[model samples]
Target: MADTEFVIEPGRQDLVMIRMFDAPPDVVFRAITDPELIPRWWGPHVLTTRVDRMEVRPGGRWRYVNVDAHGREWAFSGVYHAVVPPERYVRTWEFEGAPEEVALETVTLTEVDGRTRYVAQSVHPSVEARDAIVRADGPRGGRESMDRLAVLLGTVADM
Candidate 1:
């Protein structure tokens, strides 16, 4: 498989990230939604993730925290709007620090020739909010996170 190229495109009030994985849709989907697997690859390498709560079902609530090496924690929470295993999921995402700036995120996984194309679209309440996420180096973090996911998937495959 080729190297995964992560692309982040910002629209009027939304941001889209595209990444290709060497694994199938089911594998990639589990990597994202599985609570135990999430702590292994959800954040940057410099941080440790803690899943406070994760319920992957319609109307379910989830929360997670990532603590950097320095012990500074960043927390995020969301509510699942829809869940279609190995295919798509929609949720409302909110950073605990800025809860008012919530975004509706939809993640889709499509398998093509045994590979999965993962697309995440985050629709913010306003253009400025979406731009703020971009300015916060969200793209870099996202790219790194996905790269980590690939490595985790390799290990999961072995298991």
Candidate 2:
């Protein structure tokens, strides 16, 4: 890919954005940072993800332990940079699998037509890094997670 490919925005922030859900703002926010809820939707549809920790407050830490289809385990972790209740959050992320990688993530929640409009913005050290992540987890894994989150919200809706 070209450098312009991952030039998501003209600033140091808002490098990547993806939206794919129909839940409420609060519910979507919780699904992104809550430890108990992450495990249910934070992986490729074919893999099982396990959450070791997810502390949603500033300076807190979160860890993801994922198991591939063949029962392989990989870990990822990060510390929260900023945590704005029901609206915004920023964090530093690192994946402990393959050649290690790190990125900064910022998420904002908005209300669209009375439903949640969740946007996830991820920034990497460089465009090269961004392309690498896309190659690794692309083909809409994030979209799949968002889909899973919608399902989770549906499950909660009826309860």
Q: TM-score of every model? A: 0.93, 0.83
Encode model 2's per-residue lDDT on 1-159: one tens digit a residue.
101123354434335655645666777777777777788888778878998888888999988887887888878889999999788899988777643457888888887775766767787777677776776855367767767777887787632
Instruction: Estimate the lDDT of model 2.
Output: 0.73
Per TM-score, the best of the predicted structures is 1
lDDT of 1 by residue, 1-159 (tens): 344444445558888888888889998998899899888888777789999999999999999999987899999999999999989999999889999999999999999898898899999999899889888888777778888998888887742
- In each prediction, how many residue pairs overlap at the backbone (N, C-alpha, C within less than 3 A)? 0, 0
Please identify model 1 stretches exceeding 4 Å from their true place: 1-11
Candidate 1 accuracy as lDDT: 0.87
Clashing pairs in 2: none
Model 1 vs. true fold: TM: 0.93
The models' CA-based lDDT, in order, is 0.87, 0.73
- What's model 2's lDDT at 57? 89
Residue runs of model 2 more than 4 Å from their true location after superposition: 1-15, 98-100
At residue 36, candidate 1 shows an lDDT of 90
